[model samples]
Target: MMAGLEERLDKMELAIRKQTFRENSGRANEVNFWVFDYDPKKELEVRERIEYMKKKNEKGTEGFQLIVFDLYDMIMEYLEEKDFVNSYGRFEKRRGFDYIIRAVSTSMKMNEDDSILIRKIVEQTPENAVVFLTGVGKCYPLLRSHKILNNLHQSVLKASVVLFFPGTYTEQELILFNEIKDDNYYRAFKLVK
Candidate 1:
């Protein structure tokens, strides 16, 4: 599985460089979005592959730049900077899930509008870059993959965005971590098996 995934990623990188990678055609056969899905269970393996790719990039593999946005690390950094850990440490009575939601919400300032976090992600991304989005499993109830992808703007997504989902991605529906079934989203394409 790991070797196969690496081969797929290599092909994906080639496609991205070509800038002709389309998920599917629109109503008039127009090119659709450039969102690719990968198996979530291979998160660690994917991370290693990305690290290797980054090294290759450093060694002068050019054309498209790879930028990785690890959600778990980003959220943890935010919580620590905001001093939420100390507060949580003092109030050890709260349930783990509740504490997590509170911490994530407080750190991300999640409101009725959940797109804020996604927008922040887009803002952090560089122009004309291939992005690798990871750490979805760690953010479970706090952040849903479908929610972020659904809310993501095409304009903001200058290049292909590969979401390393830690779950099953069927034709249209996204089963997050194999527990939650998100709504069917059509804009993105599933990486071929």
Candidate 2:
């Protein structure tokens, strides 16, 4: 009964379109954060639907904005903009994978209030825009989904934030790709059942 991914996505789409999902609606006390978790193997299909929904909603025919920020792309762009792209690869090769992990973590300011990822998202968010955070699986060993959620808790993201997790959010912790179990608990609710 309405168990297909497409059907679930359609339900989520309808939910976001509701006026109650925006500011001045109900749930003002909550963070308006949500997780749309799915099977890791179906990342491609989910992404396709997300892109399709994004194009459809971003047109503002619904009187609200749907903004998607692929975290992996953000990290790449952040590194590039800061001129770290050149040394990032060489540093990994010379210093090693473990060392590169720390470097990237520090560079991204993981879980910090002033993190580059958080700042970029906060800056680009317009009034009545629903933020969709994606690419969690791709940012592995670099960006943690829980850390991003935790950091967003401290940031000024007033709009609804939905994380398109390529994993399972067990309502308590995030299991990245459904293999790596993350103990970092976040307060975001599931966008749809």
Candidate 3:
């Protein structure tokens, strides 16, 4: 069991690195990973997140994007603080955020349409940006849409590295994840890995 667990963890890390490469290709920017534990509802935390992001952006690094899956409320609050207003009265203006946050639920449920939307959003990102996702766990799907999966598989070809966080999981779950990140599946999703 221990050996199996180690193998699973190793595999997850590889997949993450690969995904990161695909996401950052041809952008000519350095990608940095930061994990923060904060509640978006808290004012102080929101401020801190904004400060951190601004500091990174100031560096003007190309292709730098942060991926956050959890603590979405904090991100929302930060956006609100910056006056990017999510909703308004009569006059509604949609604001763009610097980081990408994917809850495990959204990531797992993402279909082709969602993937396209996400791709479009990413295309609009400025320099030295970050995308984040938090609260990753097994027993839950990482990506939900088979259709989106199909689309992403069609494009990704050569992902240099993959990274995965450590967690506990059952044997069957590990196997399923392994299959999802498999190299062959990259072509099917139009994603490079």
Q: Which candidate leads in lDDT? A: 2
Q: Tens digits of per-residue lDDT for model 2 on 31-98?
A: 68889998888899999988998888857798898999999999998888889988978988898888
TM-score of each: 0.76, 0.93, 0.28
Q: For model 1, what is the alpha-carbon lDDT of residue 48?
A: 84
**Model 1 Cα shift for residue 114 (angstroms):** 7.6
Ranking by TM-score: 2, 1, 3
- Write model 1 residue lDDT over 1-193, tens digit each, in one string: 3237777778766765555443323335433334445566677787787788777766555665677877777777776887887776665555566776766666575542444466667787665566777787887777767655665633345556777777777757878767788876656666544
Measured over all alpha carbons after superposition, the RMSD of each candidate to the real structure, in angstroms, is: 3.9, 1.8, 12.3
- Candidate lDDT scores, in order, read 0.65, 0.85, 0.33
By lDDT: ranked, best first: 2, 1, 3
What is the per-residue lDDT of model 3 for residues 27-145, given as tens digits with 9 covering 90 to 100? 34422222221222333443444446446545655344444333234334444665544442212223222122233234323444445324533454434334433322221343332
**What stretches of model 3 exceed 4 Å from their correct place?**
1-109, 113-124, 127-135, 138-193
Tell me the spans in candidate 2 whose CA falls farther than 4 Å from its real position: 24-28
